[model samples]
Target: MKRTTLALLGLVSLAACAQAPQGAAADAAGSQAATAQAPAPAPKAAPRPDTPEGRALAALRELDPNIEPDRLRAAPIPGFREAIVSGQTLYVSDDGRYVFIPGVNGALFDIRQQKNLSEASLASLRRELLQEIPKSERIVFAPPDPKYTVTVFTDVECGYCRKLHQEIAEYNRQGIAIEYLAFPRMGLGSEDYRKMVAVWCAPDRRRALTDAKNDRPVPVRECKTTVNQQYALGQRVGLTGTPMILAPDGTQLGGYVPPRQLRERLDKLAQGGAGAGAP
Candidate 1:
């Protein structure tokens, strides 16, 4: 599995101040002074329909009509606008001349905050997208009172994935809900994909999932399931491996985390502290 990189630039606002004349110049400059003092015309409002944003959105739709343009807005970068298309964050040059996809090796950082601006934006977009997923499609293991929910993309055949599943009870006990989304690392048309479909088709999905993770036979079954859709979603979010944990705020934990440690990290996130662990 390969990880993708995304880049973002910082935003800075510039303000200009006009100084009024003083003393003799002040008296002679009365009329001119009023002109100078007159507040600069209110900064132009963001262009509306048929404007740059509209043009950019139209151009994008020409390529893919499914791309939602209503969310298009000026990005922190001066000449670009940000938009979410199919749950992925995309940057379009204001003139509709360029489109930036997440995952560039080099990234722009905020010197003052020492944070990766691009990743931060991507995280926000991911959180928003995840929230839109209906809970019915996910196989969730949650306590009655969950303090935080972590979404995980898992593959039955992956060793680390099984390890994480084995500890699901401990995670729930810690008040951390684990919502599972299938990611057949082997891709479609493989045994892993078939098994996932079977697990989802079972009458008792939770039991079937645990049994499969334990390497037990998951009586082959077939049904209309969102396994494939979930796989596509994982890719859209740049998933690189199984057992990929997504924190409540959309920060990726990268790999398997021990139950207790994972709980501590969730606590910090709940308290509005910086996320711990790597992407």
Candidate 2:
């Protein structure tokens, strides 16, 4: 959930914040202040296209076309959508005049709201695009001519991710080819980030990655790598942790799923049985 302030900030009425003048002077000042009327709120901003509301909505539509204007309504903030395009509740200004998109982490915002609406947006966006899959990033890790491929957004240092790595053979035994993409999780500054870049860019990425996962020492060589792109992909999908599974068809399964379950679900997705779980 995001809370946006729609009211014009500079136009706050004086009646809301006058302090007492203190003592006898304070008494007289209070009486004078009380007699003075507060200024009226400023006229709403001109809507663009039609008025402020239209402009604000146009801006939102620029983000995506699925926005239903009829579905648009006054938010707690007034002008913003009572809920944004993704059904994520957001606040808009009261006058259908202005809009703000708030940033939040956990439960600290003024409004109490469920988390990951932003994450959900990323998933929705991915669903609408990112359809063609790439091959260079994939490696056949399984037997019997693998029937499923899973794109894993992984960080080498992540614990559960390490656990998943340990089971790569098991997953393959079930005919799931594990394709890996780097999501360093610590951003690009960390050592793991650099190493993963070397792994992805290595002449034999499969060997480099497998060796790295098995704790084998690899000569670190770096070129411009897909590490950044992969991390961006992960973030755009709201990946807060590692070992995110992107099924062959792009449905996302976060965290760790056991090999048996992973194989079954992969088969299901391959057969067109999964929903839009991608992010």
Candidate 3:
């Protein structure tokens, strides 16, 4: 989802093609073979304190107590070092005097390749983090043979979210599995949050979600639920609206796409083409 053994080509070529005197050539070949087979030296460790990377790691630790400094490394940007903490990337200056958080303006695009490097990295991170979510916590509508899957952050009261839900069958038919994660736009303790909890706690969660999205009452019997956790995850991933679709690779598709168009886009992505349709 994300290297092969290296053959000693030079040694092999020399052995195959060289025609030197017998004993000397054999001795030389043996020496060369031994050298080639020897394990490569281990990489040198980063220098200790007083070094730029060291200072950056120290500063990052102060800023985020949970950061694992071992993960920090010099970034392509000359003065900045990058680290991933809780699936989000952070950049700190070599001198430990400046810190940068990725944002809309910070999203670097490779115009030649027509790709958003920042978004791609973030998407991969999101996928890694989201993989921890148990299937039991989601309301999933999957086809018999789903070719692609999408995780949608949805709110019961959001009109577009409801529209997406209404077409859930169509999405499934298109071989696109839909996994719903509750995102109560209204904060915790609000009616929307409570309703989402009710839906999540329902014995038949898929049906409950469908009914709730249709504005029908779901039995308000709350038990243990991950609705709040899902909302928090949505926030962590920078979700600002309901019906936000996350493709299988964690690419955020932003908003709703018509079923056929969504399927076509998924196909293109599967074929190694860039993501189609706006976010």
- Model 3 misses residue 232 by how many Å? 0.7
Candidate 2 minimal-lDDT segment of 10 residues: 1-10
lDDT of 2: 0.59
Q: Which of candidates 1 and 2 is the stronger one according to lDDT?
A: 1
Q: How far is candidate 2 from the true structure (C-alpha RMSD, Å)?
A: 13.6
The stretch of ten residues in a row with the least summed lDDT in candidate 1 is 7-16
Candidate with better lDDT, 2 vs 3? 3
Off by over 4 Å in 3: 1-106
Per-residue lDDT of candidate 3, residues 77-110 (tens digit): 8888886654456676777765555655344333
Question: What is the overall TM-score of model 1 with all chains considered together?
Answer: 0.61
- Model 3 pairs whose backbones collide: none
Evaluate residue 264 in candidate 3 and report its C-alpha lDDT on the 0 to 100 scale: 84
lDDT of 3: 0.74
- Candidate 2 displacement at residue 4 in angstroms: 31
TM-score, per-candidate, Cα-based: 0.61, 0.52, 0.62
